[model samples]
Target: MSILLVDSYDSFTYNLRELIERATGCAVFTVHNDSYQLPAEQDNLDRLISSVDAIVVGPGPGNPEQSHDVGIIPHLYSKYTEIPILGICLGFQSLCLVNGCKIRLLHEPVHGQVSKISLQGESSLFAGIESGFDSVRYHSIYVSEITDNIVPLAYSEDGCLMAAQHVTYPHFGVQYHPESICSNMGAEMLSNFGELVQKTGQKRVADKHLLNVQPLILQFSSSKEFDFQFEKVSRKETLSVCEIGDDFLLLNSASVPGKWTIIGFPEPNTSQLITHSQSSGLSVGVWKGASEAVNQDLWPYVSRFMAERKFQPRIDDPELKDCPFMGGFIGFISYEESAPQDVEPITSSPIPDTKLCFTERFVATNENHTFVVSIRPNDDLWIADTTAKLNTLNPSVSASNIPAKIEMPDKQQYVESFNKCQEYLHSGDSYELCLTTQCKIHIDNTISPWEVYKSLVSNNPSPYSCYLDFGDAKLLSSSPERFLSWDDEHCQMRPIKGTVKKDSTMTYEKACKLLKIPKELGENLMIVDLIRHDLYQMLNKVEVTKLMSVEEYHTVYQLVSVIEGDLHGSNYSGIDLLKHSLPPGSMTGAPKKRSVELLHELEHQKPRGLYSGVCGFWSVNNRADWSVVIRSLFNYEDDLCSTASSRCFRCGAGGAITVLSTCEGEWDELVLKLNSVLKVFK
Candidate 1:
């Protein structure tokens, strides 16, 4: 196969030429500028172009907007629809320009800089590479706006689009020079592109209208509709669904059967459930795996795994781009990831160490709109056909009338646990401790998990509420506390510490009572200080953006505080932040590490799986947001059993115990926090 290397004279052309030749195992045909040196004009140009199997557009000087500078790009782009074309820097910008995307001059042009580039979703362009890695960047112009035609593949730490691919063709572009000597694993990137060309030889470009399947989006009006669709779709054994805010995501695997894998703890690797399957669906695994490596935490593992697979139609919709709940891992991480070394080691837990799912059959729904995205290979038709089917799903069924009963530790037991926590606080062994206990509930199999989620959310209406149908178990949470939220520019953590049940008799009077309580303010301040310390460890400049603020939820009023900081450097990752500041301070207590240790001992060494953990999404943009796992219920049903009709369902509740905390008062707080969850049974 012949390869064409177009030079833009940026002093790296010759090196790029050699790299392409080596990667593709073909002799490079070099051309300076757009014009061919052949004696004839049109005929020679055609002959030179037709001789090549693939094209690599090398980085160069000047803005690609100047048509004269890179006029050949648009021409070659229009002509070479079949062959694979890789664009670098200037060529990358030109490709975006030709595709109706906007370009802008960077205020600080990247030159000889080594920056971390996070691969967005998955692409054949970056197969076998980690999610985020350092790459050599040298450019003045960048693609400012990505149109629908271009699917962004990667981004830099500063949120600049670094790599992208055509929506319909095998055309890929990178703002950084993969041919540069400084780029990490530079040669591997070029080789992957070459292999893609060889593998997809001589196929005619399909019509965009018939071939490109628009993303399927549907909306549900009421909880009844949401429940009906979930029950209908989840009848398929391999289907999954999740809820975020008012949105419900129904991910069906029936169209492309067996395109999923289920994994649990002790092993972090994916086991293929369907052999010889090429359809791209999702890899949903819980983070119960044990890892000695400090950096390979749950968030990092999910991000890396999601990046390794090449799912098709990897576009981030502008409307839901900021919705962190889309398509990455959505589940819980145990407190163990950050638990103190001295803590009684949690040997086993009823819930997985962590549960995260990587799905390309993404559905984002709310009260208003439902957006469904299927990235399965050659399944565009399936995606289009399913949209109407999803919308037309019957909502004839009403909420289940199954009887449910709640089981919790008796009042005496709770008082004893409360006194133990206060003793530690009074003795100065710990300043404050978040003592928690699990409440078990037995509901008839006929009771829909969806109904429970519906009842809790309707009553509580928390901002961070979510429902997860994790294959083995169902998780329903209405948590008001934010574990953390990170974008490319800043990192933020919001902790909810103080809680007071809403009093109908009083309005401002209730707010004043909660606001004036020294115990409440002290609890909030202690965690704030701990979180600030955590941020100081990983961030450059830490600040408490909001402090001791009262935020009212439907069931109760809470004292919340916000802490933010700039990421110290690009080297810090989501996993790093999670590792340093995990088991969120509000959940653990003042002096996070020691508090966790004391609680582990105090709670009978029982692991808090999915309880007091976190449930949220890690985005493809190298950003993530998670909610502290509280005010939640976890259900693990046994469908495989022949005679078993009952399932294990548990909900967790806790209160911060300080020296001034009364035993009866702490018990009251725990019950108050659980009212929303318990009211579902009533």
Candidate 2:
């Protein structure tokens, strides 16, 4: 069986595709609603959807009345009357518009909330599904009145139309999302639709249908038969990895529990992959033996490079088993990455849009052991030298004094941006926006970058804490959020959204109570749904292993959720998911593309640079892990800093702006985030 899903440019289109595929055991393909079908003319539609057994008009963010918002959908409905169509959310609203029914705005919008809906009568779509079942909804408009051609199938508790079907055609639609993790029996609903297509007896079901996929827990992979050329002495407690090399890249999770800490040196003149609009072509940085980027896209070029090195680990030590990466590329991608991928960032910054370095020799440390490694399986000489150099442990040195005070973002500037953010929210242009601001910091030669990272992590211990010394510049991070990580073909993303200052009055229970409110919960819930959409492309089912729950960081309490998917389940690999879901959804709010646009105007067209960007590694062994650069400080070399007596750095902070946000409340959040790193200084 096969199905063709026409996307309306909504983020959740993949989620619906996954649900339908799992329910029917059929292959499902997705294409944009604006996908070159001759703009509502049937010249190309016939050839486009000719082989599909069913058609699903996926939900999106606009009104069906606007032809552009739902391009070529009304045409599909008019032309394919017997194809067994299924409409969801916005798709449901369109069915009414074309069938002489009305779509009216709800008294109150429900963006990420669940409600019980009762099935109206006998229908194959809801055949075995019980009435008064719960389903998650994200709609502001609904079919107000059902015409004679349409028969009502269900209604929400608030008396809004929830589900309906065409009286004469095999068309079905539900106002709520049947693919949502919170939605009950959604797979069954979709399976019922499939059986309807099969039975053709008022679309009767022969027996029973079931849907399944267990949520995966993110686990650090263990190494097997990893033959070490020499034993690496354990000295991580007293000796910092920085003491071994002057120019290095490190993902240090030493302060955080149950995480990998990898440190490696970038040899002078190492192979690099760099991209910027200023460059002549992406091929300029391509590795010697690798093919040049096609039309300047680095995605496929990098994909091929990784494919050639799909290395398998050779670690034999049980204590050294937990480290995911033995050796690979460690790098950063600017929030608005370079051309071929992005048009132009809101504003340019000192750092390159993309900078990655290949490191073949490195040391990986877990909770119990530090493993010295080289990518070459038989490089015995290099291993022996590295092992000897790491034999002695030395104590970490502290800075002479706090470098300097910060130049914080002005309160008035934030107030103006907050006002613009609210205007968009109230106007319905966006549901939530992750508003952010940047500040500057100065440091003298008295303190080294390593000392600063040591102090920062000591003061604010976080799971994703890191320190990178790129010689001319450095990054000191104490991020509590994990952006994305995958071992083999399984991938996971943990997004942090809602934040509350950890005052003395705050307890775990109290924090949970406060975070459960609409203001905080809405911020987190919207991102969780957006994440599901991002993972939909990778799997037939994206699992929420851990739903929105409050987690305590050093200075604040954050609402965190774990979303995981399987790459092997679909045609996509970890690279595909990573490329599409850039600038993490939690950092950029709901309806990502639109929120990013509004953020530009609200942020005064300032580039976030390395502040909100992710920094980590893509290993040669097909494992990837990264952390969102938050509650941290970033530095990039420039002439101003070189001439000045002190080096300069930038730190960013802000919170989600919703209708519930206020000048005073958001101001407090901004200060709290900045202070998380700033407190390490004077």
Candidate 3:
């Protein structure tokens, strides 16, 4: 059934929408209080109300007395009398005012964390609620008394009206904010209202409700190996297949399956497909896709296939080309694949003493630009369970779907941790500094590494460099500063050293003065010298392409200089060069090993991972292109917590610190760099 939500602000409306959708499993349409463009107006609100089963009024920061100006309650109640109407917070106050009740401003506002509420009766609004329910309070006024037609459902210990329902009309109101996380039984409360609306609308009458089934658990015996066998049958010849490691096979069908069909294929990759005749005790069944195709008629066929095979299916990646079996299909029998089986098991041995390695390879290069790629495998692997751990150590590289180990932290905890980090910086505990340098050379701005970034696209622009389009062998970037570039015979590296205000108020002379600071230029030149030395090891001759020079980029001006050299000998592979010179001198400070050592000691862990690590791709012809992956996010398969940004913030300060850097200045710089990355939220 269609549900209409009325609210003024976007955030409020979004929260309400999320709560209702989660509770009812129904599609909800938002009607902005200020949306005059909606076809339904005061004149025809009755007709519009007649079209829907229920109306939900959301909470917002506004005076309830101004209801006449907005004409929301009048429009809804006047139009539909028999329909279920749930008013939340401000909406609740308006119901009281319009129904001849009195609202008085409280001497003390109830912002949050008030006492428990006591219900007078088991009203339909509080049908499933326990005796004393806790709810988040955020109101400056309270209803003194209920109108004659309204029946009170719940109230605070002090008798402040918290919830009430109209005796005759299907109208309800709640003074507490139920859509917030702080509200007790928030989702259940909304679900209660949803059931009322669903019953009134008769949207799913006669349809058998699907029960939520528990996830299946497989037990393994002494033999680790298992497999399943099936027949492969298809209506069409050509098909798209995706193999996700040794786990599952994704087959795309060209035509929809009309009846149950057996799919036969090769034995499982890792284990033998056990036959159903074997007494190994295994079962398989299909489930309809729970995502976007939930209500689609085609899902049952897909669900049948899954039920028969006992395989969980994932939504197809939309970015990839569509295959034939996208809508739905039928598939074959299966057997459990045996786990690993070995006559002789290898003994556990101590991990060999080896240094964690960082490799930076040259992906693509031009006369004036070069793309350097680096990978920190662990950053993409480690998963944090708690918010506290995420706050203490910032991770550089991360993978998507990594389940957050910690429960969701409150907003106040986020604020406290953030402020504590700031306090530490202000207390001279650490410094904010980037070891950076750049080259002075002409470049094809269109083809420069910075120009091709994904974040630089017109739809979602970013403040940092990004990688945009990658087609076959060619790659594109939109970097503000030149990192490194090279050709077949020669290579060059340029690092950004200093940053100045972007506004016109900061003159070039002032920028130059700021650039000359020992802490700023000193670290920058050191990195430049390091890059020059790294290139010299692989080149026959090396020289400064251009000394320190100034370049204007997006939000700020930068000091950049160039160094170039010819490839030393034929023996040098791009991989060799990357192995020797990794993590570019610009991101890590001078004395590369020492800087990294200190960073590990001062920061959370080693292997900056993806944050400071690089991302891009290699080409078939060995002409590869990649970016530093700064201002980027990693999605993991396991990490599924609500506050993912806390982890993002922890890894954000890795690039700040130098011998000459001050804690306060370093904090400021870190905040500045973070702003460049965090502005995406805005």
TM-score of each model, in listed order = 0.54, 0.86, 0.34
| Model 1 spans with C-alpha error above 4 angstroms | 1-300, 306-318, 336-351, 366-368, 375-379, 396-402, 637-643
Residue pair clashes in candidate 1: 247-365, 247-366, 286-355, 287-354, 287-355, 288-354
* TM-score, prediction 3: 0.34
> How well is each residue in 73-145 modelled by candidate 3, as lDDT tens digits?
5556545677788888777877777688888765544543345777888776677779687776655567887
Q: What is the lDDT of residue 543 in candidate 2?
A: 80
Largest TM-score belongs to which candidate? Answer: 2
- Rank list by lDDT: 2, 1, 3
Model 2: lDDT to the true structure: 0.74
Displacement of the residue 325 alpha carbon in candidate 2, Å = 1.6
**Per-residue accuracy of model 1 over 199-280 as CA lDDT, tens digit each:** 8664332211111112111111221111101111322111122321122332211111112211111112432111000112
Which residue pairs in candidate 2 collide?
226-314, 226-315, 226-316
Go through the candidates in order and give the C-alpha RMSD of each one to the true structure.
22.8, 5.5, 27.1
